[model samples]
Target: MANGGILFLWCSSRLVRTPSFLLIMSLALADLLMMLKLPIFLIGIWCQGPCLGLFGCEMYGVVSVISGMAAIWSLTAIVVERAWVISFSKLGVISKLKWYTAIEVVLLIWISAIVVSVLPLAGWNRYVYEGYLVSCSIDMYSNNFIDKSYVWLLVFVGWVGPNILIFYCSYAIVRANRRNNTLMMELMAVGGDTAQNFQKQRILEERRLWRVSSMMLTVWMGSWTPYTVVVLFNATGYIHLINPHIGMLPAVFCKTSAAVNPFIYGFCLPKIKGEALKLLKRYRSTRPSPENSSRFPNSSPARTPRPSIIHMISINNRHASTSC
Candidate 1:
């Protein structure tokens, strides 16, 4: 929850307005909601059983499935958007990526997550207590065919497929935004403009959103990969190799991603960093310092001596490789 709150503070106004940033913000929101589940979980633990008994277990299971799916799929959306924008940035499609499109994308991801999570309640499979009966999830350990099939289907939909797309998109972004290719695209976009224009264009692409996005995805996958392995072991009839205690570790590991996501996002985006810097300067100037603060109590930052024709264009273009 703090992760999402801190990100909200850093990503103010225009920073979170873009399509890609909206997806990223959606991921943070999912994590925040997931963290809110922690209190119920702790209460259950304190009771030495499921809180509210079976009903509590059911609710927890449903919420877990929903938030987990939402977070992972939101990562997919962010990376996919980054790849699309950066790969085709020279085509001037950045202007075409609008707020409504982003809102629709986020809504679709949420709807899909809800659908996948509630399937267990609809008799496709069913949730059951797991890990000493304090928590619940889809019954991956069951012998029933539908129960077994649901786990496999989920792995395919949530992990295998999205990861393939993530990797391919990451590769595409790298290929399309390589130094030479970046120059070529900028040259074409500028239509034989001066070197000064070339330099201005370069500034807009300096902070690639895909770079931080890849880091977030990698960390998220690393945290969940162990739980995935456990699920696979159970589904493949290798359950003897796993135990309840071992199973608990991976589930705990998965929560670490929620805690770490804010740091990655807060420090990584250029616009956030710029805004943070401005805020920091303002803060320091307001403090009772001896030299700088006293000498210029109300001094505003001096504007750059040269005015930029490309300033707005650069900021608008910030939505592309930089991802708002």
Candidate 2:
């Protein structure tokens, strides 16, 4: 949880200038909350044996449901954002909005998710401790069809929904890139001009966007597909073949998506990577070196000046002159 939170903080700092950053940050926040909630749920299961008392269980249920739903909705928002970016490149329909609009959408997602989850507590659906293993989930095999309905609803909204949206975004981005490349070639064949150069640059930017979008879509699908498939099987009453421990693996895999976001953004985007390197250098400069300790007081080493790239270039020029 702490690591996920730190990554979220980094992503938030790096992406503060972009509107799409809100969606990414929201997903990170949701993952962080889920990570936090997991420990508490585990503790409850350990101490109280799956049947949590009124107070603790209620809080756990709320946190679990909220975080889970927030994660789904955040992914949905990302899919929508990517879709907009790819489908309508120059229009700026979705990207022009203020960050608060994204926040509002995220808030609504959580609110709706919590409302749906709380329905079971109110007798519309049912939640119970099936065994020492299962804590708080809709009882899949319950007599209430509401429980079954809720499972399918989550499967559709959380799993299939985002997958379809992301696939569409990926397809659109690829098609756009192909079209842009063809246009650029045609323009180049007509001879270079200021407008042609500008168009070429725009096409390059679109290609870059497509690459990043594809990477993110690949990660999301690879990480969450297993978990969703497992859930689908469980919901349909094929528990005999599925191990409970196997379900946890998918959750862990899905959590990795949050952790990987900062690294993905940093490595794939040169601007972000440069900023991260600068921050790292600044942090190292401020931190004290081990050689500066009192134990080495008698032996103060002389500080060597670090050579700049300009100095290296000058030295290379002098060496070439001497050789000549």
Candidate 3:
């Protein structure tokens, strides 16, 4: 929770204007919400025992699905934007992604999450307490056709579709990086000035992008795959794994993604690191050091200053006298 909170502050403070940064901020915000909600379930279990009442269980399910879906969609948007930037040289850079496009993506993510989340409330599927009766989900244990179809739809739209896009973007990025490296090498062979430096810089950026993308995809897969498998089995009536203890494991694993996303997405970026250092320096400068206090006892380090009313009145009197 602390890590995610700090990262959210850093991203919002430093990178608010950039397009890619906005998407990252969106992801961070979703993760922050997840961090907030999961503890309630834990505390409830510890205090009141595993099985929360119907209201609490339903609330947990709503929050989990919304935040989880938003995180996944935000990641999908990030990978797609990065891939577009790499493959299309004319876009200039990923950071400058148009405001309209960024807003559209964010809107789509939240709206889709809300619409899907409300479907159960609207009578399509149902949210019920599951997994030891402490955790809540989309009632995957039901074998009816409506429930099964809704589960399939949710899995495909919420998880499978995004994963496919992420994978495709990853592949395209690799191909684009290879092609760029080849061109850079050929230029170097022809004695192009600064070709080697350019090659090295591009290599570093490609490596960073690859690392970030792979880590995100890997975490997403690891966190959700078990739960997905369990849900599918339940939907198809192929498995009768009815033990609450066994059923809860996948849900617990999936919650780890909420904690893991901040580290992977925020701190991994060089830009974010630079911004963090700058902010730290600014914060330190604004504090009253011993040396500064000794040099000027009455002066305090402040970014902005406001004059007292008395001072303003004195200034106004002096202006009147000069005018007279």
Best prediction by lDDT: 3
| TM-score to native of every candidate shown | 0.73, 0.69, 0.78
Per-residue lDDT of candidate 1, residues 62-152 (tens digit): 8888888888888777778777877777566653457898899889989988998889888888887776556677787777888878888
Which numbered prediction scores highest in TM-score against the true structure? 3
Candidate 1 off by > 4 Å: 10-15, 91-96, 179-214, 276-324
Runs of candidate 2 with Cα error greater than 4 angstroms are 1-17, 41-58, 90-95, 129-135, 190-215, 234-237, 265-271, 294-324
Candidate 3 lDDT over 285-305, as tens digits, reads 988799977998878466777
lDDT of each: 0.73, 0.65, 0.78
How displaced is residue 233 in candidate 2, in Å? 3.1
What number of backbone clashes does candidate 1 have, counting pairs of residues 3 or more apart or in separate chains? 0
Clashes of each: 0, 0, 0
Using TM-score as the measure, name the better of candidate 2 and candidate 3. 3
Ranking by TM-score, best first? 3, 1, 2
lDDT of 2: 0.65
What are the per-residue Cα lDDT tens digits for candidate 2 across 209-254? 7777778878877776775676567666776656656645655565
